[model samples]
Target: MTQAAYEHNGRSVERAAFYAIACDPRRSIAVEACAGAGKTWMLVSRILRALLEGSLAKDGHGVQAHEILAITFTKKAAGEMRQRLNEWLVEFAQAPPEKLAAELLARGVPPAQIAAQAPALQNLYPQLLASARPVQIRTFHSWFAALLRTAPLAVLQDLGLPANYSLLEDDTEAITAVWARFYATVVDSPSARADFEALVAVHGRFQAHKALGAALNKRVEFVLADAQGVVDASVPPFDAQFPAFAGLAAPEDLLWAQRPLLQEAAGNLGRASAVTFSAAGSALEQALTAHDADAVLAALLTQKGTARKFGEKIVGIATVRAAQELALQVAQAQLQHAAWAHQQRMARLTRVLIAELASLKYERGWVDMNDVERAASVMLSDPVLSGWVQERLDAKVKHLLIDEFQDTSPLQWQALHAWLSGYAGAAGAPSVFIVGDPKQS
Candidate 1:
């Protein structure tokens, strides 16, 4: 074969070998590759083989429709997988014997066994449709919601959720309503109002809203952090003293003390090289006049808070040296101050936002996808409830296939691990097949 043709044939051989391992129904595997590398194809093939093999199931029949749970990252992906699986099953069911045998062989079936598997493959489509419970192909959130729905009534009541709680796929309306409630309540609350003003002053109203929305989207993370006491205790209060630079005073005090030296240096630098130093000089002069420690710190350092360089010769001057020394101290102090202020404001805002959102959700009998995931995870983790939940899931599902597994949240993975832990090395344990592009994650 020519070089190009030889390389192509080699790739085909490699792919065949890979599929042999990946598509084996008995083996659990995780497939990670870049997009368009047939991760989904391998997943679907594995599902098919599991159905055909039938050895994993309690009955002689292969994994039933309801026994296989296939989860995707998105609804669109779930729909696509469901469609492709159905299409292939239909083709297998209707194709001529030779064609059907060829297809089965290509899907990693041994030649001698094609006839035996062909009958089952041909019957799969109708069996799937006629089965009392259809195969589950769902997004992670949807699957979690379904799991939550199966929780006992007492569990639902303990979680402060209605039995028939509606899922909020789009939480825009709820967020807006929560913000309305926040605005209404902030007027009467001094600390909340101060926190709101601080956030608004820094981010403006529109950006502040967007920031809070982003935080809300990651509320699970916030919840986890809060449970660990990281939110309130991690950042010290803004006004609290922080040790730095031989017990240097506050940034504001340092800035006021160094103003005269900074003013002198600015004038000398401006006169020495107008084009090079005029902007820095003007900024320093303005900040000194305004007695603004933040602005002075900004003028004295790079945006990232490194010491501002005004050439070796210029910086060697006594006034400039003194001013630079003070700048270094102020920059260190001010950076800490900024961090502390930000942590405080965000902690306050996020806490309030989470509270208001939960209140609104409770009032409306609505739960977002995060809520479902969290509730399911909690249910799976509870010592009392986990056994019952595991028993129910073990009876229903025999194989678990997760598409875009890398995109699964920590909580979702935790829940999956918790449930799957019970089945480890046990009889008829559900086989797991995970596929994803880590690059995409």
Candidate 2:
């Protein structure tokens, strides 16, 4: 924006402070974006501001370019952030390498050296000509999952997972399913059932999955209490596989495992219980009985208004965002099968219930399917997973953004509050943005 435009369309002092910090070589702020606050515009402006102010400069030391990290919570959002930021910077800089070089020189970045580096940033931004460096951003969990796939040791150590277990070779699912089965058995007892059911009632099932993921990730790598429990396994050699360093594992992690939400769950119990069995049964039955079963199918396949609304609210949230994806899945799917004209909706809902029964057989999935559910179960069983995820998150970000704050799973909130409150001291600490519509929650 021009000086005049900036003056006329002045952002709030806090937002301007965000711009300044994002632009400046130092300083980072956590911004709570109220509704309609133009978060996208701000993100774009910050990227442009950083580029214009020489934040993209790669000095001889080679540290500055890689120093800054911007993390969002979802794949779609991350991509949008990168594209918008890149496009804004490219257009603002005249959509050409020469323009960037000239600006870099004007900023006293050493004309000769900047001429070379400017081409890189220009190409790297993706809005311009192609080059090499990734001058953009990533989701937090994605980056970590990549770390796990590549240098499993470093990633594990960083997250404090097992130092010795093979992240890839070990089947964390096998471990988790055993625990979940045991949990079910134990819960069958009157006292155990109350506490177990109570756990679900108090927290959501998703939190349990997260806890399960954490536990298995640790047992495989860090602590195998019984040598008897050790199951020898083999995965392709690290060299034979794609390098995880390049951010390859991230998209897959999100697409399949809902890793970000699971990662956040660490020790939270909200995932398993927020929508209790009572709620699910009632919602499912009411939904199925309310509509013609055949009509429900027609509505879904035909993209009718009712189905669309349900999908937008629930599916859109889960698939696009980390905070509400699972909840969205449950809510939307329930809605989808609710509007039955005949027995169709009831049949579908019945299938949904049956689907969970055999889900135990698989221990991994692309979309937190039955398999990933098992992995999540292991995470809840293990305490170390939470610590490990906590460690990884603590190590990287300087800021955190939470959504649906009022309904935040207790375990997830505890970790977040603790970390934001200074679990890592001031160094590399993340500023926090907590945003939620409490009434909606």
Candidate 3:
């Protein structure tokens, strides 16, 4: 069918060609319709066309009522869709072809096409009603939950749990309890004690506690990389990994050998290197005074990069340049290891916390919404279980309709994509129909 343009208030408005696209029942359609632009009417019409045309059927009279899955974001929206679908079925069951044709024509369908399909629609409604055991209209979460319930054994197997678990109504108490357990252990455990000491040494006790608390909150969303086994308790140690700063020429060796300006720069560097109170600072200071290139390099390595105020002793142009250079090196070093201990501690702590949290939930046969999605995602990712799921759904669902597509999470999408794309028969794979407004998503 060709695209149609009609007059709307005072201007020409191009009518959406959704009827033609949706009527084909061969390809998927994703519509981003504005509010009050007949999105519901269009979707209902598309679903009705799929039913009347018997296009979703593999080798039968037509697709069953339960074969069409329509998912919306809200329970209210799902109710409305189910209600409207029921109304459409009833209307076709009772109305004559001419009347049905008139209604289709009003909805922008071609006259001849509507007349041809109206009779079939009238004939198909009774069977559709008879076969409607469970209406497949549901909110996204409810649908995913239903999928888990459908394949409980497969879900448990895929997640490697002993049996199916009950979902917790709320995770607040569970989270707090698990956190308390981890906190108590960390306060007394040997490894945790060492981490705490190191962290305190670098950032002080009060600052360390604040920093650790912040890191804990942030680590909740951190997924372990594949290489880092999920149960890996150890974090990479910073001290062992820090490059050994040895066998290097001093800063003066590189800059002092050039000219008067270079020698002045070296002198300034020497003065800047001597300002800190650390052993490295003292060694760097001695080496600078004695002009020992190798010793200066060694001391620079040991220096933790602290700065001091030197009122008028630092004055020359080269001296200023040398001070900036020193400050940059010191500042870079400090920034690099500023939270080295905290990070290592947090990584170890987070892994333990996550493991403990899972253990607590599993021991109690409880899971949260996130756990629900995770299990569902695992089921979809598994070849055997995913195939089984797809086979079951393929026989029941032929068209996938989603409302509020923009609000779909990655895991939710993964579950849906797996089922829809994994249908066994190649000839009649389910078509996806999505509608939403980006502005309101």
Instruction: Name the best candidate (by lDDT).
Output: 1
Lowest lDDT block of 10, candidate 1: 3-12
- Candidate 3 segments whose C-alpha is farther than 4 A from its true place: 1-13, 22-24, 35-38, 55-61, 91-99, 106-109, 122-125, 150-162, 193-221, 224-266, 269-323, 339-344, 392-394, 418-425
Candidate 3, residues 1-441, lDDT tens digits: the string is 743333333344555344555444445878776688677776777677667657335587666656778887788888888788778777877997678877766545666677676767677666665664544788776766666675757457645444657766467766777867776777878897677677678779788657655544433234424235542333333233333322223323332343344345445544553454234445655655676754544543434443333335444544544533554443443344444545666567666666677777778787666666666776676668776765665546777788778788766787778766666566667788887778776
Roughly what TM-score does model 2 have, to 2 decimal places?
0.36
Which candidate model has the greater lDDT, 1 or 3? 1
lDDT of each: 0.76, 0.40, 0.61
TM-score-better candidate, 1 vs 3? 1
Best by TM-score: 1
Judge candidate 3 against the unseen true structure and give its global Cα lDDT, from 0 to 1.
0.61
Model 2: per-residue Cα lDDT over 173-237, one tens digit each: 45445564645554555754454444445456676445444544433232222234332212222
Tell me how many residue pairs clash in candidate 2. 45
Better of 2 and 3 by lDDT: 3
Q: By TM-score, rank the candidates, best first.
A: 1, 3, 2
Deviation (Å) of 115 in candidate 1: 4.1
